[model samples]
Target: MLTKFSVTAAAEKFMRRVVRFSGLPSSAGFRLLVRTGGCSGYDAEFSAEVEARTGDETIEVHGLRIFLPAESRVLLDGLKIDFIETPDRSGFAFIKDDQRSVVAVSADVARIDVSAIGRG
Candidate 1:
């Protein structure tokens, strides 16, 4: 389980839009999977899912239901998630509580991970 996980307002808003427009049922939640990748400590893939996958734990940040796998839960411990959008790009940025972005996953590359590949 995560010892600490936080999301900024912008990140929350972004997630809400994703869920609301995902075309899934109203009960659908955002599924986030993170792994070690590249120079940064993390790489992430996310999607709106109708429900948590097997072995996933559902956590609520405010009202958004987030589905996280075991590895992701450990990776997200003590991190804060934020959303950043600019003229050139938009994506979710992961930051340690006392540092800058550890990794930024591009929205353009975000995809559904039904296969659970590369997890852990």
Candidate 2:
């Protein structure tokens, strides 16, 4: 089966740190899922799991197991997972392997459409 996403070496190291700090067992793995609602219309969610759930596709990179749900396969194809640390923030980030920016709109611009938003 084709790989839907990739985990960077830095990400692997970060996962190891997380596992060590969280007291997760050696068998622990990460699950990546796609959910609606983000600047680009979708978001990648991560969770720690002890074992693969039904319909999950497991991919191991350098002995680290990363699980992807069958439903999220298409949305996450060609994705690159990395760990970034900065003075202000430090965490995992998902980037498109194709190099496209995740934020579809410019940060300086505000897009608001009254017609598109309906009141319940």
Candidate 3:
């Protein structure tokens, strides 16, 4: 599922931030999997995988490496992840190319100027 869009800078930043916030053990790579749990019968999961699967596509963006299975690469294309901090707390967010969900930003994350700290 090779496309013109491999990964974006904002996506890379999201991964780096997740690593720092998770405090998980360091390894050579990260894995983003498409699991079955969401209302759409699919959910995105982040984990540490020691190695990439043979059918996985390795995306290296801004020094952050992520491996997504060939099957997942399809749904993940043109997808961007971001972190949000509401009054309740902080959590991750997602955006797809097809359309914006109620929770979607409906804006360009690259224009948001998300630095080390959160900005509205």
Candidate 4:
């Protein structure tokens, strides 16, 4: 798969549902980013970006691709990305990476298998 880690059935299923409903093409990819906001000082956002690899960790969720910036990896440590497609709203969220307030970035993401971690 495109991701370094595996994904969960729930995550995979959700991804497909979103894509199917969005009617986007196969070449489309989901972009993950970290920005300042919320009470947590930073939050995550996902969209579509076709830029070059930037050496970041690219994970595959469901049949779609999730791109993480190379420098943003540590911030995403222990970060759990999830897709929530509700009747009113549909998008991805930063479920969890590291609950602890450390260096904003984390080393935890390095140990995770994007695909397998989702199932866990």
Candidate 5:
């Protein structure tokens, strides 16, 4: 169990939509691999997979199955996942309580600096 990880409502909805449209079976799960990178010390890549990979821990959150490898599980602990959208981009952001760091993951970009984001 991931006791310290939390997913915001927006993030949960986003994840559900991704799985629903992934063209995989209903039992498919979202596989998230996280590592240390980006400005916030969190870099993530995700995809819909038919099943959890070997050694992956499957977690059910609000009916959505998420697959996390060992590294991801540790990195995601104590972090909150949220979805953020702007006119120019939309993606998932991992945040901690102090809000000092954020890692953005999107289809078109690998990393984004949260400090540089502003209404334009």
Candidate 6:
């Protein structure tokens, strides 16, 4: 029912790549969900969906249909989905517009502190 989230051009481009890589139908879109228990208070989930479910709010961008379930509407509002690529990492990120923070649910790289290894 609520429509507050948006998808960036980079995200749309990434989605298309996902579809091609996964061999999903062109009509398929992404479903955004939120769940508890993560480094942060909540975690964002993404899945490729062929059709929208009942009670789902659909946001269309560049011929892509991004579906948000009713339950996740509140938690995901005012967020922007984007695809970022750096020399060391690349993946999807959820940008919290209001908080000015980025939450990455899936990324190719992880941070490590070599100095902290085997130290007490």
TM-score of each: 0.80, 0.66, 0.57, 0.47, 0.77, 0.68
Ordered from best to worst TM-score, the candidate numbers read 1, 5, 6, 2, 3, 4
Tens-place lDDT per residue, model 6, 1-120, is 556777778879876655444445778877767655566455656666778888888878777777888777876678787778888766667788778788544462232223322322
Instruction: Give lDDT for model 2.
Output: 0.62
Candidate 2 lDDT over 42-82, as tens digits, reads: 55556567788998888887777778787667666787767
How many clashes (backbone atoms < 3 Å, residues ≥3 apart in a chain or on different chains) does model 6 have? 0
lDDT of 2 at 15: 61
Per-candidate RMSD vs. true structure? Answer: 6.0, 10.9, 8.5, 10.7, 8.0, 9.9
The number of the candidate with the highest TM-score is: 1
Lowest summed lDDT across 10 adjacent residues in model 1 is found at 111-120
Give a tens-digit lDDT track for model 4, residues 12-75.
6654543444445556565556665544456554444444267756666544766777644655
Candidate 1: stretches off by over 4 Å: 100-120
Clash statistics: count for each candidate? 0, 0, 0, 14, 0, 0
Query: Per-residue lDDT of 39-64 in model 5, one digit per residue for the tens?
Result: 55566777777899998999899779
In model 5, the worst 10-residue window by lDDT is 108-117
Q: Given candidate 1, what's the lDDT at residue 71?
A: 88
lDDT per residue (tens digit) for residues 7-97 in model 3: 4455566667555544444444667765445554455566545567788887777666678886667755576555555565443455664
- lDDT, candidate 2, residue 28? 80
Largest lDDT belongs to which candidate?
A: 1
**Model 5 accuracy (lDDT, Cα):** 0.74
